[model samples]
Target: MIFDFNKTTDISGWRVVDDGVMGGRSQGSFALNANGNGVFSGTVSLENNGGFSSVRYQTDQMALGSYSKFVLKLKGDGKSYQFRVRSSFRERFSYIGKFETTGKKQTIEIPFATMYPAFRGRTLDLDNYNGETLVEIAFLIGNKKAENFKLEIVSIAVE
Candidate 1:
């Protein structure tokens, strides 16, 4: 329920995903800061551009089932962003959220049932994330225009 990027002692498991594979475009990468925050920072450009640039982290063992919600600490440059969640790796099912920047260290809460189908445009229960392994965590900025964006992730945890 409480996630603070300034400290990492409470998180039981964590991994960073910065693979450079994109949907026929370019890929985004995630990195950790020397300051010790699990930082997911990258740029989404327009040249040879495909979609977005994001950094992600996933917990190895998920024990936040009934808690069924996640709270994150984020800081960005006042641009549009997406908060994504995935239940399983094999199933490419995920929900995308569109939000603006906070420009400050603020807490963003993502509930399990609020994720909607991107294609069908219907509210789908993200119950699978409950007790289900936290597969992929991503920070992305879509490459719709020739804009440069950075999303710095501080911490991610279930509450």
Candidate 2:
């Protein structure tokens, strides 16, 4: 298991990053709900060119060469989101895959081989995820408009 959220899970490593870093007015928050699931919720404001909100977790490098995909157990507000990863935290770009939630519980599986390299919403010419090692993981919502989003995540695992 890569990460799981339960009644006792410690989520201190998780952080919310909005468009404020680039002069945007987005606001996001991450926390465990009463049911013990990790909740990522926020408003994506287009004010000041801001239109994205994300939550990220950085961890020790994990060798995952044997894992071909990641499975996310989550519930969303019928919106779209990006699941992202970085082999190394120092890298400026992340390998990302987009998924749409159905406003109900769902298991989203993202193949490591299909995550393309991207930076600031632009796809890079580099190859896709190598599935060798990972140091960071994130979820981002940025549909290019102002809206509110909420995602309840039960767990994240690779298989």
lDDT of each: 0.57, 0.96
The Cα RMSD in angstroms, rounded to one decimal, for candidate 1 relative to the true structure is 4.6
**Highest lDDT, which number?**
2
| Per-residue lDDT of model 2, residues 1-159, tens digit only | 888999899999999999999999999999999989999998999999899999999999999998999999999999999999999878989999899999999999999999999999899999999899999999999999899999999999999
The digit string of per-residue lDDT tens for model 1 on 1-159 reads 334555444333443332234333444545446565655555455555345565555645445556766677777777887777665666566666556776776767777656443422245554433434556666567637645565666776776
> How high is the lDDT of residue 123 in model 2?
97
TM-score (all chains, Cα) for each model: 0.68, 0.98
RMSD of each: 4.6, 0.6
Q: In model 1, how large is the Cα lDDT of residue 45?
A: 51
Question: Candidate 2, TM-score vs. the true structure?
Answer: 0.98
Could you tell me which 10 consecutive residues in candidate 2 have the lowest summed lDDT? 88-97
Q: Count the clashes in each prediction.
A: 1, 0
Error of 1 at 142 (Å): 0.7
